[model samples]
Structures are given as C-alpha cells and as structure tokens.
Target: MSEGISVVRVTSADLPPLHGQRFDQAIAEGRHGEMRWLAEKADRRQSPKAIWPDAKSVLVCGLNYGPDSDPRATLGMGNTATISVYARNRDYHDVFKGALKRTGQWLASRYGAGVKVFVDTAPVLEKPLAQQAGLGWQGKHTNLVSRSFGSWLFLGEIFTTLDLPPDPPEFDHCGSCRRCLDACPTGAIDAPYRLDARRCISYLTIEHGGPIRRDLRPLMGNRIYGCDDCLAACPWNRFAKAGQELKLQARDDLRAPKLRELAGLDDPGFRALFSGSPIKRIGRDRFVRNVLIAIGNSGERGFLDVVATLLDDTAPVVRGAAVWALRRLAEPAQAAAERARRLPGEADATVRAEWTEAMD
Candidate 1:
C-alpha cells in the first residue's frame, strides 16, 4: 500500500547544495512573486536539517490524486468555470496529513523514533526532497512527474530520527519535449524548468490577493481557481491511472461549476458551498474576484446584469472585478452609464481606478 515511500539522509552535505542554490536563485530573482512565505523560510525549505537538527532521515510519501478525465475539457465551456484538478475535492492538506499522522504514530510506537509530519503546511521543499527520494523527477513544469502516476502526486513527509536507507534520486526524463511550456495560457513557464509566478494563472488567482493584472486576465479564460494546463499537457500522463482514493475524487458540483452560480455566492453561501473544499480558504471576496475575471473572459452578454449587480458589492476587490467584467460584456453606452452613475459615489481609490480602467 505504501510503494511510494522513500528515505533520505539529511546529514549528507552534498544532497542539498544544488537545491539550495536554485531555491536561493529563484527567491533572489523574485520568481515566487507575492508568495512572501517562500522567502520567509528559505533556510528551512532548502535543508531538512534546518527544520529539526535531531532528524537524521526523512520519509517522503507520494499519493496519487489523478483526475479521472482530462481537466482541461471545461476551458471551452465559457460559462462554466475550470477549477484546478487538486482542488476539485477535499483539501489535500487535511487528507494527506491524516495518513501521515497515523504513520508517524505507528513509527513512534514501533521504533521509538520521534517524528514530525509535514503536508504543504510547513516550509519543507517537498519537490526537491521527493526528487531526491526517487519519487519522480521535477519535470519542465517544475512539478514532480512520476512514470507511474504522471503529474498527479500529492506529497507528504515524516521527519524521523531513524536512519533509514536512502533511495537513489530520479533523473530528468523531459527529453526535448516542450509541450508543457507551450501549453501555458499566460506563458508563466517562460523557460523549461523555470517559472515566473507573476504571470502564472495559478498564482494570479490563488496567491495574489489584489486585482489581477489587466493583460493576464483575458488569457486566464474560465480558470477561476487554479490552473492545470501545464500538468495536463504532459505526455507522460498516458501511462497514468485514475486515483483510487475516493475522497480525493472530483465532486459532481465542482466538476464544471457555472460562472453565474459562482458569481452569486455571498460570504456565508461561499463558506457553506466550499466547507470541506480548499477553495473556501480564499474567502468569498477573493474567490468572487476570480469569478468576475472569468466572467469577463467569458464575454457572454447574459452575465452583464450579474456583473452590474456586483458593482455595488461591499468588497472593494469584488466591485473592482465587477467593473472589469461589466466592461467586457456591456455595450459602450451601457458601460458609460454605469461609470457615470457609480464613479461619483465610489470611495475606494482602487475601485475608482478600476472604473476608469474599464473606460479605457
């Protein structure tokens, strides 16, 4: 059941030097964008020993969360929003952590080893560690690509005092293929194995808190939450099988959610709808902001009224996005009338700029 388990000895000085250099380079170059947390814990993320000096070996586990079908199928459905594959169901952090905690407890009882479990919550570089542990090589998209599981592995780790035998690292198998690079809607993957998060649709929708850049908004299409274009473009996925974990499977409601329905969600409704889902964390305001962006990209005139109603929404971010969406769908005369009516009373500087930008 645990065929994905692999070990790594943190005591080896040579193991982390290259990873550290690349990590530091990415941070120094600001490739991480607004995710300041990545820079905040640079030392701990690069070296496992920095997290726990007593930890001699790390147990890395990869769980398959492959989608049953192609996730990109929703992109053409302009009125329907496309959510990232991983977030279509339960929060992976919760599901993966539970399994890790149980394993940690068992290891403690059997081997008397102290254990610490990490599942995306901590600053540990799970990707580099996963690569070192022979889980898979980090593909051109910078995600772990397993020959058996493709790009659908969710990683978790148990830092323990047990000096377990290490598995050999997997070498890159990307070859000359550049499918993942060309598949980026926003060209976030500017180069092979290098990503600029500032232009990444995933970062723009999730990690970025404020209004998305005007230029990148249209390219986002209907991807309201995260993106999976690069991952879906990987040819290695042909060998991938559907994940057996029922809990991680896509919920029917989330599979192809309508933009109109998503745009109407208030804070309470948003919280209720996404209770166990990872999308709940972004909050109604940010989530709605993303939805409005999708609505704008949708270019469907039917949503003009829906976008107009949100122009009066309490959240400035939502109202700002509403202005953008309205402009995209409304006639020039209708959009001007809206600006004339709302601009005078608008109090927020950013929202006011959105109104002006919409006119442009």
Candidate 2:
C-alpha cells in the first residue's frame, strides 16, 4: 500500500498559475516593459518546481504595511516630496527576507534540508503564487488584493520539499471597478491587470536611467520615488489598517520631504538619507533627475533658483533635466539668459542640445 502523506491539496486551478500560460503570453507581447529580467528566466518563472523541484509544496505568506494616515494626505505640502508607502521605512526585501528565512529554517528543521525562501527577488511569480497559495487574487491593477488585508500587504514564499497542505486560492473581487486604472497619472496600466512599467512614473523615476521623457514630466506630481496612485485608489483598502511591523512604519523624514531639500542632495547626502531604503539602488543622478522633473511639474516659479543650482552638476543627465525645469519655471527672457549662461560650460553634447532647445 502507498503511504498517504498528510498532504493538503491546494488546487492550482483556483490560483491559475501566472507564468505558466498568461505570463508567457504577456511577455511574448512585450508588455513587461523595461524590466528585461522578467524575460531572462521565462522558463523558471513558469513553474514552482522548475525553480526547485527538490520538494513538494509551497508556503506563501503576507505582511501588511498599510499606513495609519492617508498616503496622499501630505501631498498638499508643496515643498515635500511624496514617497510611496512601501518605501518609507526599511527595505521590505530585507525585512521580509529575514522573516521568511526564519520561517524557512523552521520548515527545514521539520522537513529536512530541502526548503528555500523568496520575497520579490526570485523567478517565481510572487503575486500569482500568492493567489495559488490561497492568499488572494490579483486585482484589476495586477496587484494581489486580499479580503482581510485589502491591497496593503507584502508577499513572500517558501518552496519546500515536504508535501504540506496547500491553501485554496482566493477569488477575484475587482468586479468592473476601474478606479486603479483611472487613478494612474501616466495611464501606465493600459488594461485590466496589464502594466507597461516603462511609462509608469515610479519605474521611470526609479528604475529607468537617462533623461526624463518631455511628455511624461508634467504628470509626475511631487512623487520623487515610487508611485502609490494605483494602490491607494482601490476601494478595498478601506478595511486596511496600519502595519504590525515597526520597521515598515512610515518615517517622518520621508513622509513628504521638501523638494528644494531633495534637489540639494549631493551623492553622499542622498546615500545617507536612503541608506537602508530601496531608493539607494537608483543612485544620485537618476534621483536628482527625478527631483528636477518634479520641480518642472510643480508650476512654482520660486523653484527656479533651485533648478539653476543643478545647471553645473557633474552629471549631464541631471544638468539637462535642470535646464528643462528652469525653462519650465522661468520667464522667456530669464530662461533665454539662463540658457546663454549655461551654453558655454555645458561640455556634454546632450546638455548642450537641451540648452539650445530651451533657448529656442
């Protein structure tokens, strides 16, 4: 007689595995945008066993990082830069990785040495896997939304060798609501559950390098880092509460930092401010470039002086963005004079071109 293990069957059908079929189609259509890594491991992302077949079941977990106050409430403070809630405190990758690692250790103790833990840094499709693990369903915006946690949770997973019971997949609750889609400033979310990260303000400012697109600059608002418009707009968030993780709580400094102060940061200053945070990965130039875009979109002429300061920045990309911001805030004659002053010192071909364009 075969040994019937105490295996809990979590129907993979309920979750509808992500990369196995739909994800492959999405990537094949070029919808993942500039995140080329998604295309790199196309095969592994399609199956949990493919990542580590050594085991039997998957254990998925969630941590709620929902804010006590409205994430958007501080935007009115014009001088302040609005960082996304997910980024306000210590990096979740570090936080969740520690927790999941401990959980994985415990599992390994119980099930032997065939367990692996993952947060967002793996080939496994976390959102889809979470859904399959009976956590929640992917919302219209393509983010997982839980009935208990609402849309305010961070997902982690454990791929174990033991055949433990699996949780039933949660059902979708989006139900024709387009609030997340409509709330997006850049229309990055083109359709239900489909996002083009290239145009997303969060992606462009943080993940993307080089110049900010002229057309998209005006829509960025004061968001200097990741965007929360889509996440915050969900009606299901009404039930969401403040997170239990103290490390994930909001930081007063990052709540709504002053645009002028942020624009003034040197490389060392930027490093110190975002040390334990995910924002450090973008580096100084890209971050300042983002700040310049925000200054341009602010429509506050008083910020022209701050923009002028970056004209001589070491980075051509930052200098170019500063030129664009100055032009946006300055009077025609003032802008022309500023361009003339910058034309001679602008050694970079790109900066020179931007200066000429501003003069024109």
Candidate 3:
C-alpha cells in the first residue's frame, strides 16, 4: 500500500435511491458536452450492484495529490502553460489502481471474496461512493471535498463480496460558501452542485476533441490541459497535506512549461514528454489545439511567429487554432497578409471559417 493514500472507508454496495440522478439530469440536458460515454453507461454507473450483482461492499480510497505550492500561481504567467495539479506528474489512474489492486488482493485472500477494482476506467460514480463512505461530500464545484485531504484527493474503489460495515456519509460543509463558484474562470459551476461541462475549461481542454468554442477560449487563460481554479479556491485546503508518493509528485518540467516550447511539440515529442502522464491521452493534435488556444490568450505578440508556423499544420484543428492565435497576436496588416497568403490554399472548411471569424 502506498503511504500516499490518505483515507480508506467502506460502504455497502447498496446506494441511495437518488444516487446518480444528477448524472442523469446532466446527460438529459446535454450538459456533459462531447463525453457521450457518460450517457452510454448511465445504467451501470447508478450503483455498484448494477455493474456487479455479487458486490457486497465498496472500499473508497483517497490519495492526496496536493500541490507543494498554490497551483494557481501560473495562471497569470501567460507565456507558460498551467497544467492541472493532478496531471503535473504521473497519471493517478495507474498509481491509485496499483494500490487498490494490492488492497483488493489482501481482502480476497483474507475473506476468500470476489473482488474487482476501479479507477475512473469503469462506469463507477466515484464521488458519490466516496461521499457515502465518509471520505467527503460533493462540494459546490461538484468534486469530492475531504476534510483531511481537502480538494486534492485522487479517488478509487475496490468492490468485493466481503460484506463490511458501512461508514456514515459526510454531510456538506459548504454552507454559504461560494468561493468555488466565483473562482471558476468560466462560469461552469452555474449553481451550487451543478456543473455545466460545456463551459468547463477542463472539459474543453481535455475531453472535447474538436476546436474549442471561440467565446470560451479567452476565459481559459493558459490552462492547456485542465483547469484547477475551483478546486484550489476551496478554503478547506488549509488542512490538506502535500502528496507523499514520489511518482505522484509534480515534475519540474511540467510545472510552468513555456507555451512556445509546448506549441513546438510534434507527435513524437508530445508522446515522449507526456509518457505515462495523462496529457498524452489527448494526442498531439488536441494537445496542440489547446496550446494554440493558450497562445491566443497569452496576449504576447512574441508568439505570433510560433503561431504562424502551425497555420500549415496537417491537422485541421491545429490549423484552425493557429489561425485564431495568429489573429489574436498579429497586427491587422500582418494578419491580413497571412490570411491572404494562407487562405487561398486552405482546404478545410473549419480552418477557413476560423480565418473568417478571426477577420470578423
């Protein structure tokens, strides 16, 4: 077991009747954005028994991933990209799952029970289960907030046939606290406990495959991978402890990576740099698409040349984002010259539309 795991509590496999109602509501309203998987697995995500009928208990585990310093410090550093604190090192899915597997193995040996583990891979509604296990309550930002670990926990679950005593669920402590709502760079947290993933920077940067919405690009600032503004804003973090797992600690290179350096990454470089990291899952085209948006929001004319280089990029999304960034950083004359120079040869309708939108 990794010493990084801060808390572990058990809950009965049976969940509340209204366990995943909000998820259904979010899906029905199309608030989950491009993440169709959420809706597809709606039934299985409702309860542990839905996924596995034999499961009698759930072990909810929290791994502290608190940043050594405030992760929001890089937000104003326009020339640098702000990766979410959780993604700055190795992917937590791997780290957390390893610990869960070891724990599950022990449970299986001791009780001769059937066991299965999950770490964001399954259709498990982890936050709700974690809350049910007394780890924390779902805060206004719609993330599990731990009293001991604060908002920095990486959660996983082990489903076993071993019937265990359930812990009392934690109640909401965010009474009259709207700091998380106000901290959102985009108004993704429309209401307390309500998150519209469409406007969420994390969803926009990491999940959405195509070009980002033009209106939300400016609000994203330099968050190229995921946004942590809401999570960092919670006052409960004062009690949080920095993660002790060496593999999960932040890598110095990713802390405040220069936008220009990141924008220059080709597929091989992107894969190599983000090897074993969560950022690589998005692929180079989407990753660079995010980098271009960050470049556009940087307000640094020095990035104009870098943006220009990506105009002829093979990926339509990359080309489109480059056009948007070019318009944002280049002067009217320079933008016109590049538009004239590149627009004639541009084949993708989306890239042409980006040019037109930038011109407009």
lDDT of model 1 at residue 266?
A: 88
What is the Cα-based lDDT of residue 239 in candidate 2?
Answer: 73
Predicted model with the maximum lDDT: 3
Model 3 misplacement above 4 A:
1-4
**For candidate 1, which ten residues in a row score worst on lDDT?**
5-14
Q: Which candidate is the best by TM-score?
A: 3
lDDT of 1 by residue, 1-360 (tens): 443332222322124688888988999999999999999999877688888888878888878888999999999687999999999889988887888888888889999999999988788877888888888889999999988889989988888988877777788999999999999999999999999999999999999999899899999999999999999999999988887777789999999999999999988899999999999988999999999999998868999889989999999999999999988898999999999999999999999999999888
> Order of all candidates by TM-score, from best down to worst?
3, 1, 2
Q: Cα lDDT of all candidates, in order?
A: 0.88, 0.80, 0.91
User: How good is model 2 by TM-score?
Assistant: 0.93
The deviation in Å at residue 268 for candidate 2 is: 1.0
Error of 1 at 261 (Å): 0.8
Candidate 2: C-alpha lDDT: 0.80
Clashes of 1: 0
Residue 137 displacement in candidate 3 (angstroms)? 0.3
Candidate 2 residue-wise lDDT, 1-360, digit = tens: 001111112323122454478888878887776778888988787777778766577777788888888888865456678888999989988987787787778767865757777788788787787777777889988898877777888877777777766676777889989999999999999999888777898888777888877788888888889888898899998877778788888888888788999999999999999999999989999999988888887889989889888988889999999999988889999988887676887679988888887876
After aligning candidate 2 to the native by TM-score, how far in Å is the CA of 102 from where it should be? Answer: 0.9
